[model samples]
Target: MRRDIGGVVRNSLLAGAALLAGCAGTVNAPYPPIRADLSPAALARGATIFHASCEACHRGGDAETVSGAPLRELPSYMGRFHASNLTSHPTAGIGSATDAELARAIRYAVSRDGRLMVMPSYGMGDADLAAVLGFMRSGHPLFAPDSRPAPRSEFSFIGGMGFRVITGNEPVERPASGIPVPPKAATREYGRYMAHDVYDCASCHTDGYSPRKTEGDDVFAGGMAFVDPEGRKVHSSNITFHETGLAHWTLEDFTRAVRDGIAPDGSVLRSPMPRFRGLDAVEAQALYDYLRSVPARDNEVKGARPRLTATSVRPAWVAATGAETTVQGTTVGAPPEGSATAPGHGPQQNNVASTTSQGPAGGTATAARPPSPGNASDGDGVTAPASPAAAQGSSVNTAAAPARKPRPAAPKVDAPKLFVQLGCASCHGPGARYQDRLAGVANRSEAELVRWVRNPEQFLPGTPMPTYAELIDEPTARALVRWVKAGGPASLSSTSR
Candidate 1:
């Protein structure tokens, strides 16, 4: 009888082990169909969403960030975190992942191997879901197949307990049907979708743990707490229509703030606040409309740095420099393969590498690029000059610029603009590894900061930063550093900068 009982117990244990194995992968399976599209407009929308949401963590390095390249660390996560390669490479990326798998991962924050992740976005509407995925799979140069290798995330003891044990297997209801999004337009409906569903705007703007909200009394009113990649606690400012928020802000002010990282009060926005230079005018206006339409909240966020104080304002010394003052700009993180605008490709030495209709001060600027040998630009250092008729329709087919007439090279810009337009922000921008270095710019004396800015190689040898001593004068560098020292960089693009 004792032997019989032992056999039964052994059988029960084996059965339990088999059951656990089966349950793991099926936890978030049977992902519904999204019916994504590969249209140019869809690709553009995907690029926009990717820029606003995914670029911060999934970046490969300081160079033009290729999507799907793995990053090894996150801010204070106490884990060997590696942002998974999101590219479509057959082995190195998510190329093998089925559409349903992608859907489940996005919806449930579950990894392909069944590990729960802490993704900022989950369960977007169907239209947007289709567009974003379509763009990723459309073989665009940014998301095209790449075989770069990086390690996967390895959680520590505490992290394992927090994510896997406590929050990992929570029983949240999955959507039985597809979520719906608004029509593409400059309307509040689409704007709401952008803020909540696609890329969460309040992720940093909220102080609470549950920052993601679809509809709330206080969405963009601020008080969001963020720990930068360097493990610093950064305060998020209120951005509502209240006097304490954006009550005094105009559309142009809001546009410049997002595109250039400058504030209405003249203070520069700090790092971790994404600078989205490629954000189109329609998207900007739509987002602004939604923010204005939200209920006014009186929360005055504190501990936020670079508040544009009277002391931190542009010093009078700028006038003595006898050079022009400048402001900010940038493009999305991902650049197409062989892109002329990619870092090391464009005329960055001139301090004016790119031009966009989206200007630093919320104006339009036609790019004057060097002429390519052929009639069109084939990912070369050229933009085919459009005729009057072609320029109007450029909005529809904006992603691809093929063979066209060549334009002249752009004239040189000032040193301050060079800092952003030349891609300096990628290494020092929001959540960048070296972002901590910018704080010293505010603390050090004028001459010290100026010296470092003029020739960063002098302060730190073997640095990758380009030397600007020849381009900028002592007074100019001094004034420029003082002017921008209040805030850290967000991001600058090769195309938009």
Candidate 2:
């Protein structure tokens, strides 16, 4: 009886493993071609929805700036479960996506075969889903034509090992289905769907699993980190409603920072957060709205580093100098006595190597020397002219002659009007006492204003101020800095008048 029972359990385990393998392999099925011709208005609405929802992870405008995977290039980038391009291209674009397929992908997170999909089922309302389909069929160029392989299973090894251990049987082999479906959509009730579903903003901006539970109100408090190619860590700020978030920022200030990479304090933000140089006025506004609506939390993150000083030089610089000494071994002459290293340039040289290496006046060696006049012969025996005019022309041609397309002018954004549209005044203006306090802070400098805008928790940790890290990019941050330094509405109006 005991042996019989053990055999039965083994068989049951094998059956379960087989079932899981089947589920994993057949997740993605071919989508049916879109049949209905969507109207222009529908397409326009879809575009707006896409900007608010999908753009964050996909394209984020034509700047090619990407925080998540690019949906436009999905057909080419995603390995197995490739997202079809939504452009009018003949072969791979979503011009062929059926309304049914679009609906299935959005609301149910299922493919045409009733299989689960890998997409996040976050913010897709019925209207927004329909709008996204319309935009997909709107005949716009979403991506270039390219074939993409399906994504490989990340859990295959675990499944195989588990099958071996439990059932004493080989794991079933099958093609992996990359489709993923959530039990329910988080943003479906709201009209905004694309940002939540396709872009999957909550995956990073909010803590995993129960984001609401972790962040009751603080939406973006800026503590996420990304490692660069050089292995330096870059963190994402928290965008929440606590005093540490972007509670003090204005809408225009938020827009400029995202589009331009300029901080609220007029400082440049580093790369990886690409500048949204290609976004038009309408797209920017929609994104702004979606971000404003995200629930704010109260997470107080550390402030940015204080200004760099001589003592604050990165360890990499020190290492490089030390390495040079060991390898070159003083072949590079030391600096002359009493000569100090220039501020921006590295250490000074002690002795001049050649007559042409004469030091500049004021005991500083001219770091870079002007090219020689007239023609000269090279060590390789090639004769070259040293005409400064020709050199200058070549430099200009190299530097300035790229055939770059002209960027469109940014639309003028009115902070006061936007504040009203987004109902910011409900908590910030006359009805609330918050306006009085903000008004009193008007005389602060741009830096001071930025400190308050970036995070209010430093001054008042318990106060309610949403961090705008997700919503407000660098440029928009700077604009808020300008506005705050100018004293919000009163200063703005005075300048306008």
Candidate 3:
């Protein structure tokens, strides 16, 4: 017999309630101490880390994936635990969280009560964690106003379910080493490092960027999507060499877009692409250097459209009715000429025997007929050749769906070529004021660098940084992480193993 996995799990949990009786003991652990005066640099780093890592599941109040829940406006029904709103709301937010508590949550995924938190713990380092804490302490509110019901004890079930789904009994862990620091110098190697690892420029922009299929071209031509809590969908845009891409965008334009979510047109990019607003001058310049060196692809993609209604509510019978409607020459009202018995024929001769009987009035039935040799119209008005071979072939063709065409390749660009086409050197030049700042940070670990690159807001709460998460993906983030952790050098390629 087939077993229902979810039902079985639910039943087992209910049966083992005694084992989980005291799981809620740590629900009211004391908040950590707060440091109100965090430096700009530290806040900037924190912001980046938050975007690259935290925002994947917490942006715009909703987690990007289904299992993840909304962070903002969390219903009290979810009190088993919620990703506390990171904004500076003192009464119910992370504004009062101590740096140590923040660090524990980030790197260790552990709450003050020593219980595991269900946050993703990838690419975090000591300095980076501290920077995030400093940034959070810097007093910036990212959420809009919304009141939810007060949390309750029963909500712990939600936390338990989340733990089962997201944590899977895993213990909290941290990065093995201290955060690496970058040097003060302008090097091609460093530029590549910042682009590939720190900022994760290649993640969502490249097609087939997985470790197994990393050879495809089309760098920076975006096509990524995220689902919101209410089931809305958002897509990443193309940033390539094509005219419709970011071809005309200046480095400043790109920078502003990444850090602020403000497009060149002055529009706010929607959720999941968190506003950076936290990057410092040095980190921004480093990102600029890397973007300049990337090869450009010309792939153009359509912007996002509204999501479809929930599948559950859609009419199930509509599909069957539609399929029947599309069969050529078939009609419910008409019957075929030869199949209809003459008026004088008896009831037995008049009724074409159906293989499956239909219920009286509301009954259902299946109708089958012996093979015919000549082209003929069925009583249902569907014109089919009576020949068995032809009918079989037609049925097969209808059943075997047509194949789809392969998607076109994305554009590609070499490092130096991209620098020239995009005019990156205008702000990131050697000896330039901005260049000196980026040079100082060429050696930060990939995780730290990516934090800065994706969004700077987590660190510098009110600073001006742009979000690059739209232009990158997880794989590219990993690649950049390797490059940054290895000292932000081109020769230090780190695409997994």
TM-score leader: 1
lDDT of 1 at 435: 62
Across 108-161, the per-residue lDDT of candidate 2 in tens digits comes to 445544555444444344444555677665545444333332233233434443
Show model 2 residue runs off by greater than 4 Å.
1-37, 51-96, 112-114, 143-203, 209-236, 259-261, 266-296, 300-497
* Candidate 3 residue-pair clash tally: 38
lDDT of candidate 3 over 10-118, digit per residue (tens): 7888854533443433432333233322778777676666555454444332222112234432334435334545554444445455666765565445565566553
**Candidate 3 TM-score versus the reference:** 0.38
If scored against the real structure, what TM-score would every candidate get? 0.57, 0.39, 0.38
Off by over 4 Å in 3: 1-69, 72-82, 85-101, 108-125, 135-176, 184-223, 228-231, 238-248, 265-267, 280-282, 291-497
Task: Estimate candidate 1's alpha-carbon lDDT, on a 0 to 1 scale.
Answer: 0.56
Ranking by lDDT: 1, 3, 2
Once model 3 is optimally superposed onto the true structure by TM-score, how far is the C-alpha of residue 430 displaced, in angstroms? 50
Question: Cα-based RMSD of the predictions, in order?
Answer: 16.3, 22.3, 28.0
Candidate-wise lDDT, in order: 0.56, 0.40, 0.42
Error of 1 at 362 (Å): 24
